[model samples]
Structure formats: structure tokens, C-alpha cells
Target: MPEVWERGADDEFAGRADDGSYDATARVVDARGVDDEQRVEAALRPKRLADFPGQPRVRDQLSLVLEAARRRDAVPDHILLSGPPGLGKTTLAMIVAAELERPIRVTSGPAIQHAGDLAAILSSLAEGEVLFLDEIHRMARPAEEMLYLAMEDFRVDVIVGKGPGATAIPLELPPFTVVGATTRAGLLPAPLRDRFGFTGHLDFYSSDDLAAILVRSARLLGVEALDDGIAEIAGRSRGTPRIANRLLRRVRDWSQVHGRGVVDLEAAHEALALFDVDVRGLDRLDRGVLELLCTRFGGGPVGLSTLAVAVGEEPDTVETVAEPYLVREGFMVRTPRGRAATALAWQHLGLTAPMDAPGAGAPQLPLDGEGRFS
Candidate 1:
């Protein structure tokens, strides 16, 4: 049986704070504390499931989850939201709290470096509360282990004294839902991953979805935008709502400063071009990688580090920022040898591929009679 302790209630948020007293519950009430730009970003975030654009499957599934919990009058099960950044994982977590009418405690995995840190937060959760843990994969190992038991049994053991003479005092917690968001789901341990009753994987939005998002953002920001303008910006938004909104704002600036105070097609094109975003959503850094591969590296079987050096960026940035979209759009390939350019990349850069270039419509080679490479 789980031990029950009636310690006085204290709410705790997972984000960093330097305070000894845990009496006050930390809340991400709004975007008020952040800079003006982030405040605007928050204002543009959709408040409900209906308003959020793209990721239909995730939306529908999350709707059912929230609806089922509502029908039962019980706290929703722990949910794991996995996706690339800027695809609305955090937004969806906030929306979940709104739809449930629950106060949310927001924090990130990196903030909880010790088991005690996680335990302190877990022990303070109010009944039926929602806890949004962002970048959950970055949490420390001991903290993660502590979280597993907490998620399963709603209890955490408070350790006292040194390891040899330590005693664990079990503390029972109220029923609360953890809404964890992670950019890299693969990094989560199997035990932690299995604890979540629901999981949502958000993919990049389509051009149409991005356009709709931009239109919604424009209305909220009071920007006059033509449909063609919205469509143009969306096509170059890198298939992300965050990027779409950012591009829309940039275009709005351009329209106000240079052209009429309206986001027209010309304004969208000129603004994006000035920012080095091409029509297909490839930015200067993206094109630099492609150009380096096709022109300098001869279509590249080059290592990521080598490529990054050539482009004057960190290897992680090259891999995480540029490579995913490039690979997704068929512009590049992660070969066993290394990163290589596809024929599409050459064409996109307005360059013809050499006859012997990788992915340049090469014919299949004949196999020997012994089934060996010819």
C-alpha cells in the first residue's frame, strides 16, 4: 500500500526559480514576463483545438483524450507530445489546460537537474492540475527515474541522510496530469515513455495549413493581408506555423515601411527575398549547404563536420536546422558514406548535375553471376 502524508499543500512549477519557500504555486499565467516579441507570439497562439491549424490526426486524437476525461470527470492521463520545435507542442499543452479548465504549472526538463528538484515539484502538484514539462528528454537520469514512479503510483520517496544510513519517506500526491513535450522522443527511456497514456507526434504543416495559420495570425496582429500575399508567405514559411507567423510579421514591416500598409504579394516576395528565404522556403544557410555539396564538394559524400565547417556553422546546426528539411524535401540524403545532395538540389540551385553526380539518374549496375558487385 502507498503511504499517505497530509503535508500542507504547496504548488510548484518546474522552471527555474531561486526561492526556498514552496508555498506559492508558480504559474505561466501569460506571456507577460517575456519580451515584447514573445508576448506577441503568445497572443497569436490559438486558445482552443478548433483554432489550431495543421496536424489533424494529433488534433483529433487529443480531442478524444480530453473529451473522454471530461466525460469521466477525472484527470486526463499523462500525455507525451513529441515533435520538432515551432510545431505547437507547447501551444497544445497550454490548450489542453484551457480545455480542461485546469491551472497549469509549466517547466522544462533541463531545469530539474536533481531528483530532489523533480520530487519537490511533483509533491506539490494540486489535484487535477496539469504540469507541462517541455524538452523532457533533457532531464537528468535520476530525476527521470524518480518521475517514473511518480507517474505510475502518484508517490515519491523523500530520502533522508547519506546513502548508507538514508531512509525514504514515501509521500502520496494528488492526481495530476503531466503534459511532457520533447523535440527528440527517441531520447526518452522506455520506462518513461511507457508511462504516458497518450502520445502526440506533431509533423510540419503543409503549405495550405501554414497559409491558414498566417491568415489567422494576420487577423490577430491587425495586419492587412491579401490571400495571394498569405499564400506567398506560407510557401516560404518552412512549413512551420511559428515560421509562418514570423514571416508574416516581417512582411508586415516591409509593407508599412516601403509599400502601402498592406501585406501584398509583392511585399511578401520582396520581404522574404531580402531575408534570403527563397520561394521554396530554403534560406541562405540551407542554400549554402546545397551549394557547397553540389558545387564545391562535387555533390558530397562529405561528413557533417566537414560540411558544417565549409558553411561556417556548427555541426549540430547544420544537421538539425538545415538537414531535416533538406532531406524531407528530397534535396539531400544521409547516405552511409555521409551527407550527399540529390539531383533535385542541383535543379533547385539552378545548376545542372554532372552526368556522374549522385542521384543524377544513374543506371543500375549489373551484378556478377555470383551475385557480387560488378
Candidate 2:
């Protein structure tokens, strides 16, 4: 866990002390900094689909869908965007609204606790408006049911009263579009999933694409970044654009304070190092999991909960946040027994894999021609 810095009235930020230097306690390397990103992400977001980078297939498909709707002079089909966090799912939703030249109403699944809450929002939506529901998988069951009828039939049944006296007043709604974004698409009910006319899955971006995103972000933020500095941050961003932008800001801070107000390769390295991010984009928690697996467990299969306990983290955090990247990068494997470190993990940690270690002589899986196991 990252250290906590107590905030003072005089402190410029919770993560900074009265002095100019960073407290070194903030979680600067986390990809899921939703609260922090919200403050600056709006300005950095691409307003239109044409301005967005990466996800070529999704971009093209979305463009065609929007253009077709425009030619028809009607609302576009409901769009479902599925992907890991921080890969521009929300941005794409906003872009859909922008491209259609319509107003957008943004809400998340957790915010809609009741069917009535969803009913109110749906009834008030103007024709052609886009409703962007984020984290759609976590929506309450009743609200999810309510959304189903609204999406398909453009109507909602608003219940009025209680018990047998309750009456579901059929409410006709204006034709509109729903752009739903979910990090875990599978959790969405099949009926709700099927309601979407277009589904787009976003993949992790390539280094070149991430570099392009960084260049654009630097220009927007007015940060003078060298080519190598941008490349360095992009390489260590774990294939996520949000992480890349956050690291760029930290490197910019480091440049302003220590260097000559310019983001260069050295500034990027120093900033990332101070934030506890390694060259391979592994932060403290990530390295902790690998170190414990290789050093303590003898590279044997270990239960997820056991690993999480040893790392002082929740099991869900270990599984969702750390495990995906570790497994995807070939540093770990999920065996029938449990989680086990691979030979790559040992090599990355500068240790040798024992002959009895799990995955020591295991057959390597074939890559899908994308540097990922098929």
C-alpha cells in the first residue's frame, strides 16, 4: 500500500506537504485514478470521434453507425462499449453524442439504486439525447429490468403506490440513444447485452498508439516533452492511455521542480522511479505479488486469497487489478491448482527458477501473433 499523507490547510495537495516536494506517499502509479482523472480528463478528451486515437476497428464501426443514423435523421442504435478500465470507453460514449450533435446525460449504474431513479431519468430525456451509463454491469436488478423496456420500446412502467395498490403507469419516452460502458461485460444480463444494437470491445493499445496519444496529450497540456520522454512514458504505461497521461503529468511536475521545466528522458525516469513504477510498469503492489510468489512460495501454486493476504490487499484487488496484467504479460499463470509464477517472473526478479518450480519445464503456449497467449 502507498503511504498516506495527512492533508493540511496550507498544503497545495493531499499528496504534497507545505514544502514543494511531493510527499512520496500518494498512489501516483495507479491506473484507476477515476477521481483524480475526472478533474483533468474532460479537457484532454477528444470531443469528436475523428479526434480520438487508437481502437481503429471500434472507431470505424462507430463512425459508420453514427453516419447511418445521421443520414436517416434518427437516433443511432444503442451502443455497448466493453473493455478494461481507462481505455476510453467513456470517451467513446461522449464522442457518440458529439458526432450525433445531441445532448448527453451521464450516469453510472451504482448511482441508479432503484427502478424509479432510472424511470425519472428516462422520462426526462429529450428525443435524440444520449444516455451514457457507465459501469452498467453493477446496476441494480430492478433498474436493469427497467432499462430493458426503456431501451427496446422507448417506454417505462413507473410504479405508483405500494403492495397490491401499486400501479405501473406506462410512461411513453422519447426516442433516444443509450451508450453503455462496462469493464466487465459478462456481468450484464444477456437480455440487456442483447438490447444493444452495436457492441464494441476495446483492446489494449500498442506502444506506437500510446506514444501518439501521449504526444497529443502533451500538446493539450502545454508540456514541452522530448520524443524520447514521450516514448519512455508510453512504454511503461501498461498499454493504458489514462496511465500514460497521469505519468506524463508526474514527469512534468518533476521537470518543473528538478529539471529546467522540460520533460525529457531523464525527467521521465526520475519521476516514474520516485512514484515506485518500474521500467516494466509494475508498481509496488504488482512487484509485491511477484516477489512473494517467487521468494516466499517457492514459485509453487498459491491460492489467490493467500497471495492477497500476504500482500495486505483484498482478494478482488489482487485478482482484478494485478492478476490480469501479470497473467497477460506472461509473468504468472493460473493453473488448475492455483496461481503460480512463471519462469519469466523469476527472470524479471533476477532469480533462477528451480527445477521443481511450477512452469519450470511447462510447455509454452502459442502466442496469438499479438505477443499474447492465444
Top-lDDT candidate index: 2
TM per candidate: 0.86, 0.87
Instruction: Kindly list the per-residue Cα lDDT of model 1 for residues 38-97, writing each as its tens digit.
Output: 778889999999888889999999999999999999999999999888999999999999
Off by over 4 Å in 1: 1-35, 362-374
lDDT, candidate 2, at 220? 82
Q: After superposition, how far is residue 124 of candidate 1 from its true place, in Å?
A: 1.8
TM-score, cand. 2 vs. native: 0.87
Q: What is the lDDT of candidate 1?
A: 0.89
- Model 2: per-residue lDDT, tens digit, 1-374? 34457665676567754554665555445566776567577878999898899999999999999999999999989999999999999999988988988999999999999988998899899999999999999999999999999999999988889999998889999999999999999999999999999999999999889999999999988889899999899988999999999999999999999998888999999999999898889999999999999999998699999999999999999999999999988889998888999897997899999887656788777964345678
For model 1 the TM-score comes to: 0.86
Give candidate 2's error at residue 258 in angstroms. 0.9
